[model samples]
Target: MASPAPTSAPTTAERIRSACARSGGAMLAVEGLDPTTTPVHHLLDDGSFAITVPCDGSLVATVVSAGNAGVQAVLEMTDYAPLPLREPVRSLVWIQGRLRDVPIGEVPALLDLIASTEPNPALLQVNSGSSQGEGDTRLALMRLEIESVVVADATGAESVALSALLGARPDPFCGMESCWLQHMESAHRDVVDRLAARLPASLRRGRVRPLGLDRYGVQLRVEGADGDHDVRLPFAHPVDDVTGLSQAIRVLMGCPFLNGLRARGA
Candidate 1:
């Protein structure tokens, strides 16, 4: 398979914004609360939704509905706080953060905070604690985790490149299973096939698979064996942009682990 011709490169911000526009809109049928007390409505020119209720103190939860997807952000709107009292509602924060390029390690803490501040006292608890309860919250958390992994993996390629430049190497490990990893692996194979065709006959056996999805696009493992020694190439990316696939491969090949393998064959 010949590699596709290069096209213009879009910034990470542009790609994320495009994805959010495509998948961000959501409509939610909220239950377990008095419709009259905290009526949901859209605010902001961009269609960001919110629901506010009168409460003693500054404790408030803002529900953002975009299409069928929704995320609840909680805030303790008060004076003199270290971090912003505002926290994302369930997975909504996570999804929005990824689209906005928030860091990965910070996601779990945000999810946990939303989980703790639930079933607002002013509002009725509809499906709260039921088997199917916390549906929106749970879904949001999952989405956040997935998106976080994908974005982190995509953008972390630079770290891997830097490590290669600094003489870092990969230790052997088996692959983990997850939806994001699976998507990345598929993309890796596609890129590998295209690159293999362009390679000189001697390097034809190069293979690619995902090692993990971190705060980059995906960390990949590329392997080849020249009759004797085994060679492994490690790399990362922020997304599966085919036009940049060749550049990505070149970055991976620079890693010391892969460099060692290539030297073995040489």
Candidate 2:
């Protein structure tokens, strides 16, 4: 994880970039085009992602007729907490854009860009020559030129400017967020139990789960008679490293083992 922005909510660009880094797939919906789901993808530095579809697919045919085929379609990408919790999806980014067919000459450069960043093993299937590659002719790459984006989560929904998303950086923990969070949920039950004891009495009806952890705070989800309620416990200050993160989490959790009693004012 990285430190929160000094003052304002993270730039719309930051959130969008982080969400894209966290997303593996997105739903592509356009009028007169069947929703397409192909995995050979890339999210360029410019805040656009390319999805390869079969040559005969309606999406490509739509593109053949209209240069701005994507202007009316929606490309929805979502990020979910790597671990199980009362609420699994942490954020969603809905991108609306103009879709375009990758020119033949641009495909090589585009594929190179995608390969360098996305290490999806399935990419091994993209062979340009007819010698040994199968399914090459059936595939065509299309790019979504993002015009607008909407990021929604437990925090709420907000529109992010295309420029901001393209300029922002993803969380440092983006790659390992899932693994660490899953470890916390599975290997740290005692810690969760201790944290649960601190929840407001009214919300202790069912279960308490660690919802998320970021430089700014720790989130908890409590299942109650009515439904689930989420609470964010802000750290005293922003944390930029694992040591700081550990100390902050300990302080927030009241350092149960350090003393017989919870810390004062914790």
Candidate 3:
């Protein structure tokens, strides 16, 4: 037998695209305090990325990139506060970079350095022998819920749409299991409403039974002559929220393995 042709290694972009496809859709759970906010969840598609502390009165930076040879990211300083736009006296050359890596404890010095750069006028004045540290520390806390879906088309135009729908990289910490369930309930309600809107006359004529919620999630059973189809919708936010749920419904409706139930009939 002849030797097989060598396989080419996937390019970074190809790897990213494949990861995005595998992700299908995902929700993020984010949390942090003042200046810098760390996205707790690691996105499957991209290596570790983080959101920098707000500067120039903004809460976030537009562009974020992974750290060099590490599971961390550096905030592109220029995006949030450009040098030309800086107010000379107030801006002390704001060159301190923001970086975060997984197993976060590894960079204690870096963390402290970044934390020091936070807008702490009280601390600055106290060190300068001008004021005490009694002034309020302006800390902003928020929980952001993000859902991402990949839309690849032949024309490559869908990438733009997908990016638009997904928006900027979300804080991963936002998609905690508890938060995920909450979002899932919201999604379930939305889906059920859509299905109800397209209810078939025949089914509407039949008895409508309400199924109660359970530990796993909610279930709604509908009886029909062909057979009873139990429509069980899992309320756990899928890896990728929208695409995962959409694919699940499509599978349930299309598969002969599953009871042929038209969740939304034509």
Global lDDT scores for all candidate models: 0.30, 0.71, 0.30
Query: Taking the tens digit of each residue's C-alpha lDDT, what string does model 1 give over 1-266?
Result: 99764333333333332222222233322234332222211121222323323331121122322323433322111111111212212112112211111123644454334335332321232122244444232122212112121122222421112122123211111112244345544555564454334445555654534443322233334445532111223234333443344345555444344323555656
Q: Model 3 over residues 1-266: C-alpha lDDT tens digits?
A: 99764322322233233233222122222223233432121222222222222222233222222333222222211111111111111111011122432233433432334345332222222112334346423221112222222232212322222243234343222223234434434555554444433445555443333332222233344456654443444433333354454454444343333334454653
Residue 138 of model 1, lDDT score: 16
- Give each model a TM-score: 0.22, 0.79, 0.18
Tens-digit lDDT string for candidate 2 (27-130): 77888667876556566877677776656567777886777544466877777867666668878778888888777788778777787877664454443345
lDDT of 1 at 35: 28
Runs off by more than 4 Å, candidate 2: 1-12, 38-41, 54-56, 68-71, 126-139, 256-266
Query: Cα lDDT of model 2 overall?
Result: 0.71
Candidate 3: global Cα-lDDT?
Answer: 0.30
Better of 1 and 2 by TM-score: 2
Model 1 regions more than 4 Å off? 1-8, 21-151, 157-195, 199-204, 208-266
Indicate the worst ten consecutive residues by lDDT in candidate 3: 86-95
Candidate 3 Cα outliers beyond 4 Å, as residue runs: 1-67, 70-162, 166-198, 205-266
Model 1 TM-score (2 dp): 0.22
